[model samples]
Target: MTAPDPAGEAAAALGADRALRAAARHSAGRLTALSVSSVAAAGAALAEPALLGHTLDLLLRQDPAGARWTGWCAAVIAAEVLLDAATARLTGGVDARSTARLRRLGLGRLLRTAPHHAARHSPGELSARLTTHATAAGGVPAAAVSAAVALLPPLGGLVALFLVDVWTALAFLAGLPLLAILLRTFARASGASVSRYQEVQLAMAGRLVEVLAGARTIAAAGTAEREQARVLERLPELGAEGRRTWRIYGATMARTSALMPLLLYVVLGVGGIRLAAGALGVGGLLAAVRYAGLAAGVGAVTGRLAAVVRGRSAARRTAVLFGLPELAQGDARLPEDGPGTLELRGVRVVRAGTVLLHDIDLRVPGGTTAAVVGRSGSGKTTLAAVAGRLTACDGGRVLLDGVPLEDLSAEELRREVGHAFERPALFGEDVAAAIAFGGGPPPGAPAVRAAARAAGADDFVRRLPRGYGTALRDAPVSGGELQRLGLARAFCRAGRLLVLDDAMSSLDTLTAREVERALLRDVRPGTRLVIAHRVSSAARADLVVWLDAGRVRATGTHTELWRDPAYRAVFGDAADPDREAAGRARAEPSSRPDPGAVLPSVPEPPGREAVR
Candidate 1:
């Protein structure tokens, strides 16, 4: 399946407010523990300063209470400072474990998604989500809980002030509405900008990966400058967005700064006049000012809360990244460990409205060799593919040892049948490893040497710096050499069915003939299917099957087909001029052979393919 739309992914990450809440719940126990300590610390911190103010006020008037208040103030200050440090440490530890659990769940979901889901997204984009997004989301518990914790002490202080003087509490309450407006404006506006910045960060990561991967292509095309320009252009846009977020945050903070001091001035100025006029005591005025200072920390908490909301946006994006799955549903059935006879029953392959192979009913009976012959486009390769089950047939069943191919698991089929194509692809591993790649060396040196010798690669491989042990990077091997190694790997597989899909096409005719002879001489007596262009190679097989326009036009020994006009028409008249002369050389009898022996008595056309 193609990837779900990017918009859906973006929407999911952005809309996972529920996931964020769920994560919070997971962290709740820890958060509560930390909050308890944090609130206690905050109360201690507030108490010491209040006591200090009391001690100073008493000292100024030389009251006897001054001596008692001084000792209490000194002791309380030390305990409050120690508790605040301890709570901060506790909060840090709890957040670490919560982030780790969230990471595991998100990553596990992604691993379950299908392979096509992975193919649709870039490695860079996925990495960005895991790294950048996960990092942001991981802080959710601490930020949300810390804001609440920080707000508590100030709230408690405000209540104390309310009890001391109603007019001072009223003055502080007046600033609350304006302060709220500023924080709301900052959070709303900056939320969008921070989200934008997070997106750009992901894009930048993706772009960096792309640039590194395509460095060679970019250099060859002289496109480095253009790519640099594109990156440069995007950077400023991100920078500008970041600036906007900062300004909004700063604006919110500015209002809190202005309001805190204004409340203090209004309370002190009014309370001083009231005290002088005998409406309140000097001690009460001092306490009211100290409480007002404690309330000011609310602004910092509000700013942190806003940043946390934005960080969570990143976390949600990363979680979606971890949700994508890789790969498809593979076949699950197993092979019976019996005859690996491969058969294509009335199969036709069609592509782009053109028939590639039609009604190709061919079989490689167990412990037999069969060859498919045709022109370049006459379906020789396609017939070989059907027998190997590399490409699926559009019509009819391909059976392995009488079992339908699809019913057998892919691993089972591969285990039973192996193929060597005209072109072979090797991984970035070294030469010796690629040769042994179909699996490890075939149990012993004899098996590995025989397989390599059969492919005519053992000689050249031995001449390399370290022979079979040579690293691929240390020596240069041509494509033809790689093809030989691929064949060696296929031979080493030792499956019941071996398929050579024009595998010898890369070698010269002499070398190809040498390899062919060695293959027949050494490979196990398994059912073999050879797709060949040269008639001589096809003639070596026990049965020769000819494909023309996706159909089996002829099937017989080479000499028998030489006399048939349809076969003659396709391959041209035998150039030997003397049928007897060629017959004597081949030592094949000049009598009509049993047709049913080599092929299933030429399939009739009325059903699917018309026998000529």
Candidate 2:
């Protein structure tokens, strides 16, 4: 684990406390019931010793009421047993519901936050927080209730002992300070150890997940053994922390074990003296000793306190996720038939104190394409992300059709702006469903097929074992094929604006050319912002925006900017042949299809327009 930040931990602890309170309130009804049952059980336990003692006295005195008193004693014992059972049942229900509530809140917040914020935690650490940490946090409500109720038995026992005989009560009271010291020490030591254990566990889990994601690379590189060793580097620390937690617990229990009997013996001796002195009767002496034993049994609360400490520690880890800032949305809608004009005004993006995009100002006319070209680290992807509102710019504003992007409602914004990245995560039952998955309802079969064809994905999809119905897991797709499917998904929900962030980089030259043609011809007319590394893509665009070192270097048609050597060097020597050919071809571009040509319109899907 990395060095702990005291301020961050303090803040996290405060948030965790708030989250735990919310969870408690969520299951308040059940927790209240649990508390009632626990109190009832304690009452029965306290009444049993006194009732039994009275019955013994009655029997010793040869009274006829002895039998009835004995029956009462049995009833009290039975009630305590039944109440304990009810308490256990209620505890389970409270734990389950509280855990479910915590998981739901965490997941909802994660989904609502910006993607970059969510990416701060690894998959394994997130899993641990949502599963194990959530479970521990969920148990806090019940454990806290139990711990509070647990105090009643000892306190009631002490009161009963005082009623029977002051000397007996005094003996038990003498041990109180020692028990308090033990418990305080246990809580302090256990909390620190449990927190360290959980931190190491999270680190190990994160390393394991990171290794698993790169397992193929490790295997190919013949470094699997080294990676395995790296993942387990912290195993010794984890074990040490766990042992320290248990050792603290064991030491507390051992001290309590040694102390309880000594106090009980002292109470017994004092009670015997009272009986001999005629200050207490036989039954009173019996009741006094039993109550003394009960009072001295305060150590029982140690386990409950320990559980609460563990849960509170785990809550701190899970509560960190709740601190992620959710992206704020608005209530405005885009204007009807606005031609999908997109404009960036003085836009700037900063991450980790480094500028990703600075002072970017550009506009793409309605129903036209603008290709953004730059070197690998020059902010092309950042500009694409800003245009689509994937990440809000730190400074300035972006507007789609004269309305600020932030002003649009989430539903309206998602329905109007579609994006496809180089590596898209497909989520659906089958290939067709994956393509149809978007902001709107699933498109019909014809629409799905049209989009697949438009993205040049239909041919390979048809060869799958079950065609469009093939299960996603059963259909192993190549990188280029995956990119096509991602494109198809974007096409199936063609909107006012489409942003493609190097979405065609994985495809071969001919395939990329065909998909580009289909994008303009078969997809709906809209503003297209393509982040390009290929010369041919820039050459075909109506305008090109060249970015350099987080700033816009130039803005013009590809032919107009080709004269600059700096612009040519962006593609490098590997692309020089294609650059020259594309330049020559764009200079005499009457051979390509008409830019204004319109294809036959396909039936639009419900809730959004479809690819034509």
Global local distance difference test of model 2: 0.88
Runs with alpha carbons beyond 4 Å of true place in candidate 1? 1-15, 21-30, 53-71, 278-283, 322-612
Put down candidate 1 lDDT per residue, 345-463, tens digits, no spaces: 88988865788987767765565567777656898877777677666677898877777766766566677778898887664365556655653232355666778888888988999
Q: Report, for every candidate in turn, its global Cα lDDT versus the true structure.
A: 0.71, 0.88
- Overlapping backbone residue pairs in candidate 1 total 13
Which parts of model 2 are misplaced by more than 4 Å? Answer: 1-4, 574-577, 589-611
Q: What is the TM-score of each candidate against the true structure?
A: 0.61, 0.93
- Residue 520 displacement (Å), model 2: 1.6
Q: Residue 3, candidate 2: how far off, in angstroms? A: 6.0
